[model samples]
Target: MLNIKNLYASVQGNQILKGVSLAVNAGEVHAIMGPNGSGKSTLSRVVTGHPQYTVDGGVLEYDIGGQMTNIIGKEPDERAREGIFLAFQYPVEIPGVPASEFLRASYNAVGRHHGLEEMDPIDFDVFVREKMKVLEMDDKYLDRALNVDFSGGEKKRNEILQMAVLNPRLALLDETDSGLDIDSMKIVAHGVNTLRSKRNAMIVITHYQRLLNFIKPDFVHILYQGKIIKSGGPDLALKVEDKGYDWLIK
Candidate 1:
């Protein structure tokens, strides 16, 4: 579970997130929808301890296994090791690293942090191949360099694959639907849906409601001008899709 209160954040010298407060509990999915420059992505980065965003004031806390811990000063890797996952809006390519090698290294690193046994190559291949079935991914992808020359859909599916493998406690998806075709969107959504469980929470940040059609959120939030202005149920997304943020912003 995560709790944020009156959070303010800035990049460089300009303030972005102003007085943003939200709570997410286990077994719930929250969708954050907003127009351009509304600090939607900033909120996700701030939560995951992105170095560029500074927490100017207020509280950002995470209750990991019944203990309330403040993440204000935590490093990004620290937060990630603590079970926080952020799927970037635009995944970057690591030109030389093969996807399989990268995934195995990442999985083993996280495993060591959580005191879980590391998987050997054979075991990891079987493990990852099984999870690949959820996303309909083929083994050919594993042999390619990470995200290099991958289509938009392939990159998005790759992010979902990473998520499925990590199985974090809280997942923040920043525009996972962007630039994805219908088939790709469904594949990504299916991977997310398959990963959903009562013990994990998801915060989906999107501009349109179409992605929500695939992954139903328990709560829908409208974030505008660096703060969350309105919060409602799934119907809220439909309203935004129909009337635009103008109806809610005004």
Candidate 2:
């Protein structure tokens, strides 16, 4: 579970997120919707502790063993190790490192953080292959360089693949629906739904309600001008689709 209170974050010298507050409990999916420059992506980066962003005010906390652990100054890697996962809006391409090698290294790192043994190469292949099934991915994908030369859909699906393997308690998907076709969106959404459960939560940052049709978030929030202005159920998304952010902004 994650709780943020009046969080203000800045990139370079310009402040982006101002007075943002949100709480994601276990098993709940919260969809954050807003127009460009509303700080939806900023919220994701701040939550994941991106280096460019500085938290100037308020508290960011994560629950560990029933205690509210302050995560404001935590390093990005520390947040990842503490079970925070962020699916970037645009996944970067690593040209040389094979996906399998990169994924295995990341998986092992998280495993070590949780006091679990690292799997050997052969064992990791078997373990990752099982997870790949959830995403309907091919074994050939593992041999390719991470996101290198992958289509937009492939990169998005690859992010979900990482999420499935990492099994984080809190997953922040930053516009995962961008650049994806309807079929690809459905596939990616299916993968996300498969991973949902009582032990984990997701914060979906998106621009359109189409993704909502598939994932069906438990709560919908309209984030405008760096603050969450309205919160409602799934019907809120349908209203956004019908009336647009202009209505909400007004």
Candidate 3:
């Protein structure tokens, strides 16, 4: 449902992504594994239209309503409205914004953009409660400040909770496994897998195979120096876990 062709992106003055390209089909999960500085995060951020990232060349075409449109010229919020979601590795804590309040506003905004009816406070609360149940997240979390004073795992779970609620066409999970303990990792992964379907796609950018074990991807891509250097099935994850990316260093 999404395709990026010869995409080049840079930050400040340094170019990170160099002619990267990939295609993601609905109902398929893709894993992008790479060493640091290979532009993995850069790719995700650029695809999401982060203001800090500048597209130097190439086209980022997104399929919406069966029509392909170039998205390199769109803003981050515009990209989100077009059905792209990016779950941050480190969720920023808005000190005073309550989680429930933020979520309701976000959900309502997306609904309004799609010309759908916006949920009132009560309806939105009920909707969020249902999603929280699916994610197995505690209702008490809704009373707390958004990510403020939350544990690393709690922050990550909260992100997944947002994903389950919004149901984006494509979700870009950037290092969702970082800083998570075994139990937390599995919980988060389960949440992601449960939300996957014939109409949604996921691009999981990770550094470890443990996350892949839980949410097995249809394609595993090894990104080196801003390009996809290798692709295979699940066995590549096993090999990387065994080999430690040493051979891919060159």
lDDT of 2 by residue, 1-250 (tens): 8999998989998888889999889999999999999999889999998888999999899987778899887899999988999999999999999999999999999999889999999999999898888777877999999999998988999999999999999999999999999988999999999989999999999999999999989999999988899999999999999998877776
Whole-model Cα lDDT of every candidate shown, in order: 0.94, 0.92, 0.90
Candidate 2: where are CA atoms >4 Å away?
Answer: none
Sort by lDDT, top down from the best: 1, 2, 3
Q: Candidate 3's residue-wise lDDT over 1-250, tens digit each? A: 8988888889998999888889999999999999888999999999998888999998889987788888887988888877899999889999899999999888878888999997888988898898887667887999999999999989999999999878899999999999999988988998998999999999999999999989999999999888888889989988998998878776
Per-residue lDDT over 1-250 for candidate 1, one digit per residue giving the tens place of the 0 to 100 score: 8999999999998899999999999989999999999999999999999898899998999986689889899999888888899998999899999999999998988899989999999999999999998898877999999999998888989999999999999999999999998988988998999989999999999999999999999999999999999999999999999999998777
Candidate achieving higher lDDT, 1 or 2: 1
What TM-score would you give candidate 3 relative to the actual structure?
A: 0.97
lDDT of 2 at 114: 85
Residue 39, candidate 1: how far off, in angstroms?
0.4
In candidate 3, the residue pairs with backbone N, CA or C atoms under 3 Å apart (3 or more residues apart, or in different chains) clash, namely none
lDDT of 1 at 78: 82
Query: What TM-score quantifies how close candidate 2 is to the native fold?
Result: 0.98
